[model samples]
Target: MPRYFTDEHEWIDVEGDTATVGITDYAQGQLGDIVFVELPRVGSEVARGKDAAVVESVKAASDVYAPITGEVTEANGALEDDPALVNSSPEDQGWFFKLTIANKSELDGLMDAAAYKSFCDSL
Candidate 1:
């Protein structure tokens, strides 16, 4: 019911057995200007806590990891043409993918909003 975020600054919204995943606003801010995004193919299998994609920004390149084991069901192809959306809306329209969650138990290892906020502050 609540959003979760990783120490690396990726965020996820889990609903039922599915999850919507993306980089956080802070991540985009740290990355500066996003220029390119390399996303996983739909249907690709992703392991829990593994790198599943890469976002290349003007400042640097960062990998996006799977919040939990899952299959990529959808990718935001819109980023191909307009990566700036990530800078403007990291939590909304900039979402990178929709995953068909495969290892729900892995969610337990993820940080809830409050924890994530503290984690963000630590960075």
Candidate 2:
């Protein structure tokens, strides 16, 4: 799978035409302890750069954006009860949702791991 990062701090791991979405480790670290998550419903169409979910932490609530336009295929139900998984494992079990990619071309606009690391380092 190939992973990409968005400027809004979201990550997408592409596998075939579906992509798994989540907040970056950096984002989780900045959010402190996560307490709640509001997920988008399956079958909902999300536009690139639009708000798709909400993650609330002890510090503040943050919007999770769609890295690319697509239909939400599934959401991580585990997050509803254990939002702290985002802090402990943002890239794996903490993934927010999966989407069937609408346009593969949109991915070219996102950053690869190297570029994303540089972008994060600059901040």
Candidate 3:
């Protein structure tokens, strides 16, 4: 699996035609203590670079954008009860949803781990 990131601080881990999406650790840190998450429903279609979900923290609510156009295949129901999981494990259990990719080519527009690290460092 290859993980990619957007400048907006969302991440997607690609495995075959499905991609798991979530906010980055940096994003969670910036958001402060997460209290709520609004996730897209399974079977919903989202366009690349559009808001796919929202996360609310002590600081503010932030949008999580889709890195590629796709149909959502699943949403993490656990988030409704344990939003703090986002702060504890944004890359794993805290993942918002899985999407069946609409266009694989859209993945090329995202930054890899190394590039995303540099991009974060620049902030």
Best by lDDT: 2
What does candidate 1's lDDT look like per residue over 31-102, in tens digits? Answer: 888999998999999886688989898878888877678889999988888988999999999999889887
Worst 10 residues of 1 by lDDT: 101-110
lDDT for each residue of candidate 3 in 16-109, tens digit (9 for 90 to 100): 9999999889988899999999999899999997889998998888888787899999999999999999999987899999999999999887
TM-score comparison, 1 vs 2, better candidate: 2
RMSD in order of candidates: 1.3, 0.8, 0.9
User: Which lDDT value does model 3 have at 114?
Assistant: 94
The whole-model lDDT of each prediction reads: 0.86, 0.94, 0.91
Query: Stretches of candidate 1 above 4 Å error?
Result: none
Choose 1 or 3, whichever is better by TM-score: 3
In model 1, which residue pairs have backbone atoms overlapping below 3 Å? none
Best by TM-score: 2
lDDT of 1 at 92: 90
- Model 1, residue 53: displacement in angstroms? 1.0
Q: Rank the models by TM-score, top first.
A: 2, 3, 1
